[model samples]
Target: MNTDPKVLIVTSAFGDGHMKVAEAIENSFRRRGISRITTLDLFAVVHPALNELSRRFYLNNTGYTQEFYGLLYTMTSKMRPEQFMGRLIHSMGKRKVQRIINEIQPDIIIHTFPYLAAAELASTTGSRMPLFTVMTDYVVHGRWLHPQTTKYFIASEDMKTTLMSAGVAEEKLVVSGIPIREAFEQTQDREALLRKHGLSGDRQYLLLAAGAYGVLSDISSLIKRVLLQSSFDVIVLCGNNHKLRAATGELFQENPRVHILGYTEEMQELMCIASCLLTKAGGITLTEAMAQALPVIVYRPLPGQEAGNAEWLSGQHLIEIARNEEQLVEQLQRLEHTAYRDEREQHMKVFSRKSASDAIVTEALEAIKLRQPSVPAAKSMLVEGQAKTIHGYY
Candidate 1:
């Protein structure tokens, strides 16, 4: 364990998806023999009150408050680069984060959540350490493209072009796919994975992932609607919402084909047994599903980042958006056809099945090495010595 190369990962629990990606990257680093890793939930430590507010807003009153978040995103989208709320949050969070950074004194700081990208930029100002951001969403957000970022890790080619258009030097971006849990990359036979979980490939599996905060979002209604029209087994994973899970579990108890679980680490296994997913277009879940070649039906994606992810998925043909129960049912019926299944598999082929976590850790190490004075100039070459490796076309 070379304690000299300590890396600090800054994240938040605004959503479980972001933290999951950070955890994946951290695990990847450890797997590659880079053991000096520190992961922090910035909001948890820096401002517990604000974190609680976010939790209540998203988890407790999601239906009523979702529009407010949408309005905020719309406002931020139209506002000038210098006047964004993201900038304000950074200004407010900078001092506390900077103090933490000074104490940790890490060689590199990687951020998976853009909630504090601006704050992180401010924290590392004038410091010798390098700060990089791995964009958690498939779509690009101005908040994630920090002007001072040492490097930008992205999920897709389109994001790179958006960043370049925003004046980010093309050379500094790395396409590392959305960082997913290493479990998604574990080798296992499809039959074995299904049998281990008492699932049958003979019946199509529909996996529903309620968001981390546990806002039901009418997803259970959508699932029930779909179940009424089909014989496929429905497996719903309501992450962290025991009440919602119990309520839904009872609702489906008489129906032998429906299963409900409250927060389990068996998501990858479930994905292997499932053919279709119904969930929010969270970056982490979306990427994991793609890694497993599971086509998805997205429901009520959050306004900014998640909406972007849904749009990307739609463009990729990896998913279809269904904001209402009717639409969700309609899409599921349409996707049940063998033709749609073939198309979905073709779309899944576009995604990289290999572990992005490993790729991210490799790039992180290279980024650190590039920052070292001892590394030769030739070793500093970026992406095969091209001034910019553009893949948005790919």
Candidate 2:
């Protein structure tokens, strides 16, 4: 019998960060020769239609009604996760999570997103499946916390402090940084990458990433102003946003200075060649940029987690928060100064925890070899928890 520890990585596709983090963890495990791995999208598996509907609503909410969305997020952040509403939200994927746990009997259950059903299932049933949570943001909310979580791989010391204040044991919080793909961990030839993209390594190039969903409404105007007001060339990466790519390409077809691209697998290569990154404050993208030590400029992050991430990282001096096009241009101009660029790069040096996935995998493998997890086949039952007041915020 070929025996290997069965691993289950549960993630959600509400944001690209969750799935990306799952991929990083899966790839890291593969690299470490752990082949018995299964990756699951909890929401998609449990409620496909609802998952799709909610994802669209989420995109719309964050893109259009960010204030309302922030209010919701803030309210939920203060929630006692085991309470009624919180438990109701947490119960969404319980049945499916239980089935998977029963089927695989995984030695580990890792979460990239805050799908706490597995943690809940284990807690109520007295099972210890070694649930691991990899928080992809600079900030930690109550959603990512569970008393049953085995370990928390967080993005910074600030998050550690937040968790400590929340009563999470210091030993359980690992400041591993947000886990990124293997591509970032490996070195690439920057000059060759520049040539492949039909660019000379001679001039400064500004990379404008329109986020994973291509939701930046002001991207076109923003680029026009950047091209007009600045001395640097522009390259727009409209990730998975076919509409944005097509529209941007048509608009900038006549302008050789602006290079518009669609979804690309070589984001690391692009980051390697770009002088600086102008993008959303999504946790994964910021983590990816940090891995490359790429100076980042986030233009008015949407409220909620984006705002929280921007606020936390800004204090650390890891990224510049530009409130408007004028401020963005000012930030870009600052990048032209060799001294300022070097300063930003040095800040990243202190923040970037290289190969966070590898770090988690190393610890996990050791733990697995050290002691077999005391877990049994998961069983479905009524989840009981008390209602606790969740602080509401604006």
Candidate 3:
């Protein structure tokens, strides 16, 4: 009698943030004793070739054709609810997604990606299973809203207002602060982490993470400039970009202050040991850096979501933006001041909420209980009201 609530976490691989959020939620479920869990990438399952091609195209475009990509993002962001793209995506993915739902019969389906699959799942008849969406970005886009989303776990109360203004009911939105892996929330002894990684703990560390795809621009130039300063050591995470690793290794081989690492599972440990993080403004990385309470220096954020994230974080004073090599050097130098570092750290403490995963898991469990047939009719009525209210928006 395996009676633990079944959960299906539907995510997409278009970006690493969605997958990371999925992993975080999955980890939270396991911690809460939910054994029956399934994680799936809708595109990978429904349209494998398109998934691969689109993912490749996205990576390449974000790395190179950023202007065109931003244009596309802006156009799509303004799409109306009746737009054809949503319907087209729903049609393409619905059958496969519905089949998965039929097989698993999960108590709930959690979506960490954009809401196309959720729109498909919602369109299915007799689809009583609750669907919850976790918005990885600080800003909300039109694509993230759907009538079928029973709840939205967004990054902040301001986002909740954004959704509500767009017609989402107050009860259906939770300000969860972007769920991140539990490992990030754990305290790491800075000295132990540095010793284990064979780095000097006495010196301040500037952690340069270019994301898992090595999407940042002019990383070598940034590294070269940072190395000229004797106040801090530079640690660069090149992720899975072999070309980048090779190029950087050759460039910095003689420099003892520089360390280049490939894709690593030790991000939490690394973030913990670093005095500050210098990276592009991917939502998950921003949240992760904030979780570690490490001051951030954002450099060359990509055109769309990354730019939005940078704007929000910088506005909050949780991060400093460096638009060029000169600005990057200046921001790095600014980190050396005790007042500046402490001020940013305090901002991080106020802005970052590490309990998002746990909070989401708890709310989901409650939603499941309310949806149970044994629950009171009044609770069911409330859910129905929410669904109807959301439908009115569409």
Candidate 4:
């Protein structure tokens, strides 16, 4: 491995989960003494206006008409880069990627989000670099698949199997788990974290993870329902959504059991103290919660990739999925049983043992050591005095 490595982590703002995964991978690379890391939002860089419009459309479509989003997901599940929509999307950022490759000359390019267009720089244009794609969700959406991808860092064996079934070479896939923040790697003290958060062990905590957008629907009603079910306290994480936080705070301020908070960096601490989690099925949060052995309950997951993530994990008994308040509460009630909680915890711990970020870094670097001018990106960027390639994706 080079003493000083340049890494470009291409991510999107489609959801904060993808960006969070990129951050985690960046942190991991930094730990390896590799600096010169740049995290990019490729679409916004290529065409800011269109990116914003599409972003708004995504938010509106997913937040309101989720059934349509699911239908789209199903329709595009088998799309190839040569197909109409896929070709259009995959063609967006080639020039920007080539310019970026010439400018930064990164050693390796990792995609925490799925943007297949990056591969066109090398795959179609005869450039070369190591382009690794990391799937942040449980679903293997066709958007992420491409023949040019050097490696596929997937979430589970299930995804590897799916990709294999799709004719992807088995050797090209790595079940290294999803990359999480460096914070999850440290030893978190339960008692100390409890004191720091003004929480207690006496009361079981129900964590409502609204993620970065505060996307939890009818969250107040859900909180009220959970309160009615038990004496357990509630902690709401309204990420970046100040209005939702303020409204939730105003509504629940008088209730001693309910604590509504905006974005706080003490997420690991909160998850440490939490007895159960009620949230959407975004892969990054689910991976973080599972890594802490926290029982995850997906409540009315938005109908596309979220539904896919919830279904697969739930089927394996690793997590519970609820379509309504009643089922969500029922899942929480079941967690109250010591035996049931322990069983779920056991399933979660099995997954927690895999050090995803570290494994990814080690394997990527080892590949570099083994094959000097690895992949397309390395072809332009330098490796041992030769020009290197750029793993160009955003």
Note the residue pairs that clash in candidate 3.
Answer: none
Instruction: Judging by lDDT against the true structure, name the best candidate.
Output: 2
Quote model 2's TM-score.
Answer: 0.90
lDDT of 4 by residue, 1-394 (tens): 5777777888887763787777777777888888788787766676679988867766763455677777888999998876788778788867766766667667778887677667866777654567889898888999998888889998888888899999899999998888887676566889988888888778899988754323445778888899998666899888677778888888889998998887677788888899998877888888888988899998877777988999999988899988888897888888888899999999988866356878888777765553334334423322231122122111
Most TM-score-accurate candidate: 2
User: Across residues 331-372, which tens digit of lDDT does each residue of candidate 3 receive?
Assistant: 878888999899889989888897898898988898787553
Query: Candidate 4: where is the Cα deviation over 4 Å?
Result: 61-64, 210-217, 369-394
What TM-score against the true fold does each predicted structure earn? 0.85, 0.90, 0.89, 0.89
Instruction: Give the residue spans of candidate 3 off by over 4 A.
Output: 1-3, 61-64, 211-217, 372-394
lDDT of 1 at 393: 4
For candidate 1, what is the total of clashing residue pairs? 0
Query: In candidate 2, what are the lDDT values of residues 157-209, reduced to their tens digit?
Result: 88899899989999898989888887876778998998898997777888887
